[model samples]
Target chain A: MHFSPILLHIPDGFLSTIVSLISWAITIAILSVAVKRTEKLDEKQVPLMGIMAAFIFAAQMINFPVAGGTSGHLLGGVLAAILLGPWAGMLVMTAVIGVQGLLLQDGGLLVMGANILNMGLLTAAIGFGLYKVGDGRKRTLKLGLAGLGAWLSVMAGALTTSLQLWLSGTARLDIVLPAMLGVHAVIGIGETLITVSALAFIFRTRPDLLDPAEGPARGGRGWIFVGAAISLFVLILSPLASSNPDGLERVAGDLGFLAQGKDAPFSILPDYTLPFLGEGAFSTIAAGIIGALVVAILVFFIIQSLRTAKKNA
Target chain B: MHSNIFDRYLHNNSSIHRLAPQVKVVIAILFIFSNALLPDGDWLSFAISWAVILLLNWLARLNLGYTLKRSLIVLPFTLAAITALFSVPGKTLTIWQIGSLELILTDAGLIRFLSIIVRSWLSVQIAILLVATTKFPDLIHALEHLRLPKMLVTVIAFLYRYMSVLTDEVIRLMRARQARSAVLPGRNGGGSLLWRARTAGNMVGQLFLRSYERSDRIYHAMLSRGYSGHLRTLNQHELNINDWLIIALAFLLIAFLQLFAHSIG
Candidate 1:
């Protein structure tokens, strides 16, 4: 019923040192890129970005009761990305999370890197990637994509948080992953509703703000493609990281990939193996990379064919 | 509007308040890191860390009770670690059968869970002290001096400056909504859940528009005052011998605690 204000912020000592440090490395690298990208911003837009950060910080304080006494609030990552572009959105989210950690103690300083990565970087990337798909599209379609992006960003955040906890040995992957996803699945709907409604309001009122040219530096669609690739890579690797086979097997069964008691017809990465590396963590990671790469290339070709067909038509 | 409720900075002229912001920032971070790195169930090391924190609190002229109470904010989140009680493998302390499932509380799990609580509490105490002792602007300056990206630092500065203003705006919006939506004694106040969420979303959208317009006006005002892209602060803090001595002492204490934690294991 009573929701902790900063529920998603991973506090200190929850994450293992290795996971924390690795998250820090990834966050620092991405933030450096974000900083460089937003470096050429117009002098006027700087204040806008700052106030937007404040707006997000303030927006998160607003909670709408979901069911029972429980409530859910806007995370504002996707909303920010839609208003500002991804780079600026990430910067705004970072500043908000930073203040939440340093001043509010909502998240830990040591694991602040992981918190920022999970809640800010990944959310912004996923949210913006999906939302940008609707660029110049019909109004309803754009709103639909924004809602979907908002929902998925929450899921991505929950997924990464589960992975971090699992990797840190704080919780078993089999238990934490499904539990987190299930709860966030509901919370994410709230995110979707709020983001879509808010975006709809903006669209109706000041349509100029939604225009990419008038916004902060627009991230190229190339960022979307790269984000998609990275997400696919992580998703492919996740199941292998879980020690329990039933988790993946059950998923396979539900997806109709595993028939009754039959073995899968074929295993591209059988037992997550590589011929050169044999069976170990490294082999599993290598196989995941190969699988992700194969899927990405296939999708690329399909899109390429569709584009060419449209041109010919 | 009681906007400063979120800003816990207490006006005091203690030595900790006068210490270099960067020095305090570095020490707080190092202290937290040392605490986090301690092995689970290392009560001795945790005790020593608490002692150090208490001593610092005394020096800062802060009410120990106030800081401890503030640090209790971490308690609810400790629920996230509850699953560790059953999911972790160890010697079973207790076992309960619920329907088709067996929930086992392991000794190792209990130790780890308690350690997480203590570690978070200790770290949060340090954070509360840091924020309470240092001004927000000075904190931002410290971050900039530490070589954080200028643009990011500037945004953080703006965020701190405008946080209260936006917070007041949000409070006003909520008050308006509450006034319109009246509840019976036993039932809900607002419309259907979807409507309520939409209303909140609309409020958010309204807030965004206001914030965007305010930023424009703020920029124009700055420009009128001959504002440049760069922000110059009045205070230029150079680390004095006392600040260096404190840093050295903090480093040694943290190193010693870490060494003690490792030695025990």
Candidate 2:
């Protein structure tokens, strides 16, 4: 597998324009609602949310090598969902994933929905479920289990994405499953470790920051706004994501769809580079930096706007 | 800096943002669902799809250059996937070699490839426009109102909030490495495998540590507030008449699009 785990790039032109647009629309709409609700929460919490969203985007950049010939990126949905709440987690993941599609093009615009469903919905939901069991009096045990669940679900998202590709007939099961699952399994261990560590850190550092009993903690609908603001910045570093093909690519190669990969005409941005704009890794690095800058600026303003709203309210 | 993306996207600034997330979600779902089922070769249907998207894009006022630039990441994946069509053993339109296997561009292969491209471009553009127009926070708020599972919504919200925090930490580490002689002399980075691998590991460790601390702080706050798992809040989400109109319009459009696809097929 040639996949670089730090980045899970879902290529464009895989899904049609309609799919991409609809996904964008849906995500934006949902994110907006999330923001509005989050705005209504403890106003002070907004900045904190911004910083946390940045953390997720940052974590996504770290790649771990896998068992086979590939690697897997961190599917941090479980970690986020467990800490924030599943709904909040999903919205944040979608925002990050959305910016990846729009700004960095880490994932295809068309399949944005599928991408969100995989990384956002699955990881967060599963992580949340697992975290719930562990969040009891035995928080240490809860944290441990939550870590395991988070790791498994990240792989589950990868598996689900693989299945979606295979089901769509663009990929073969035998090759994709082994290629994806194999590498992801190894990657999953790292995810588990990271989740456990993160959980431990949170539990140990400021356990009171996340107690469910807090009034604003319960009614912090305003956090939704903060989370959405964070999503923009979450993708600031997507251009830095590993350019290697993911699990699906290996599977596609082994199972036969590998040959289908080809360049497109009328495509303004090809090869993930601006084309004719410097060569080699420099352009890629430059793009990543610029992309990150763009995302960061966008998010800053978004947060600012939300802050204004809170003040006005 | 590129506020142009959003400025142009939300040409309508009155109340579209206040609509429920579910309506938009349902509309997007219906559109994509029918799109997937549509015949691959239906030029008319494709045209209709294109028309709808283009119209939406235009209405959103997105800068074509920015939108396209942002959309570039889709290329490699699309090309890679379409490249597979060349080897499906169908009627050969063109044949060549890239590395080892003979890459064949068959008619069926070509159609599959083209569909994938179209799908990628169109879908991404629309999605981008959607985000450009609607604010992100409002979108999630809408989802909560729509009866989307609270836990799921909360998870997504957190991921959105914290993803960037950790990434910056990675960059700082990268910068620290750059400060230490770096790889490319003045550039502060190298192409060495060992260096890259070490950096990746260290970065991962740091990310885990930072995120761990943040989650802990948030958890304690939750507990301090008397949270027993159920994230309770009284924020009510309402779908206004405009929202209903949007949903109805979406249904009508999808219905027509599906009908058009079937007739053409």
Candidate 3:
């Protein structure tokens, strides 16, 4: 029922050490190829790369609300892939997740690979496939397709994460699949709007930059209406998001993790609930709003630092 | 750029830090996998996992204090996941209640929770250690050798390269916001929530626009440099006896933990 601003993903217990390590290894392997691949690029691209990566990191902090008290952030993998090539986009998304894990504590280091695969590669690759399917034709249609791709990928990522939990034997199949699919069905709408709107704007103003593989094409605002209408749908329908336990909870209950998932010892607040902020509908909304702002600020700092570095370099 | 930050975690001179990147990469993954898989109830297995990671930390000569700070971020999620148990009431698990929500913090539950926390802490630390020790490039190089999809690996590398630059654009947008409105402590009249909201909207728009432009530049750059979308990396030297020994030992330890956890669970 609460909107966790800083997404509390992949609770430590759900993943085994081996799972964590293997994923970490996978993350590194991918990252290295990214660097090697980029070695031949101009010095100019390096600074640009840093900036885009910062943008992805910052984007996560700015979340939009949906029904069911659940809000989602910009899963940058798809968008990044569209802008940068899939590899670069994936790396940038990973960097965002990496910094969030290491410095911000937004995601877990143990589950870094999962985070990357989910948010970065899955969304980007899937979205690219869908975008190609639409053939980058009209603006409204292209943007619409982009939004659908974005939304689907977010849900896809969530579903995959749930599967990982199941594979780890931390949760049961019966619980993880249905529950994860449900919440994400709503979350995907929010994702669709944000991603589609952003892409639409870019497609209209600077169609040249969109889809590294495709050339400039007509972009339009009708798609914006589609995106807005979807947002409106979310605005109207989000309140109905099931109060049933999320995928993690469902699995935890059936598997053994439900009992094991505990709060950290050092947090000022016992749960995500703030002491001053009483737990209620009003409080949840307030927290969600505040959480969005907080992410905005954190993202601002990360981007700011990157800009300074660019200048100095 | 901020490539240094990528290198910042690695490039240390300690023996643990100097160990083969591939070996460390493999070991770190196994360590985390085992940590996640180990049953919740066993105290000894958790202790041993912790002990092993701590030993590695000591050998790596990591900045324990600084690393502790880094690990603090994941702490909250770990705490929150267990929140429901404290609220769902029953005669079963250990009992606790928050308002109407009854929780079962049973002895078994508490033990299970502890194992999760310990496992997360250890696994994350090991990751930090891997980055903290191995140069970012070498880690990726090891991965390339390990048969990762090159396309995906290339994506990660690019993000690391460019994320910082975009961060600056965001800062400038925010600073411009504070400049027009009041941001200083004494003059804090203009920085109300509404104003901040307006600024946030503008910033997101601006960010999207700027990112779009940057992509244009990057695309041209990619073509100019003859990026055929295929990244070919120079493979590192093969793993040696030490690497095999490390991998073997890591697997053995993981196996041992699994057996121990089963016996206790």
Tens digit of per-residue lDDT, candidate 3, span B124-240 = 777777778876667666766778655434544665555456655655665676577644676535443322333343456569777757766777777788866554557555888
Judged by DockQ cut-offs, the docking class of candidate 3 is: acceptable
lDDT of 1: 0.78
In order, what are the TM-scores of chain A for the candidates? 0.74, 0.59, 0.62
Looking at model 2, residue A81 earns an lDDT score of: 75
For model 2, residues B1-265, the per-residue Cα lDDT tens digits are 2132222234455343344656755665566556666766676787788788666656555566766775554565553454436534567787776543355677876676677666666666655655666655556566567675554455445554444445556767756765864355567344433234334544554655565567668777867888554345455556678778898988888888888779767
Minimal lDDT window, size 10, model 3 chain B: B190-199
Q: Per-prediction DockQ scores?
A: 0.37, 0.17, 0.26
Considering only chain B, report the TM-score of each candidate against the true chain B.
0.95, 0.79, 0.82
Tens-place lDDT per residue, model 1, A52-116, is 99999999878787788888788989899889999999999999999988888888888999999
Please tell me how candidate 1 rates in CAPRI terms.
acceptable
The fraction of reference interface contacts (C-alpha pairs within 8 A across chains A and B) present in each candidate is: 0.65, 0.27, 0.22
lDDT, each prediction: 0.78, 0.54, 0.56
lDDT of 1 by residue, B117-211 (tens): 89888988999999999998999999999999988999998998898899989989988998998889998577667678778888999999999
Preferred candidate (DockQ higher): 2 or 3: 3
Q: Estimate, for each residue in A105-193, the C-alpha lDDT of model 3 and write its tens digit.
A: 45665677777766665665666655554553765555555655666566566656655655454443333444554556555555555
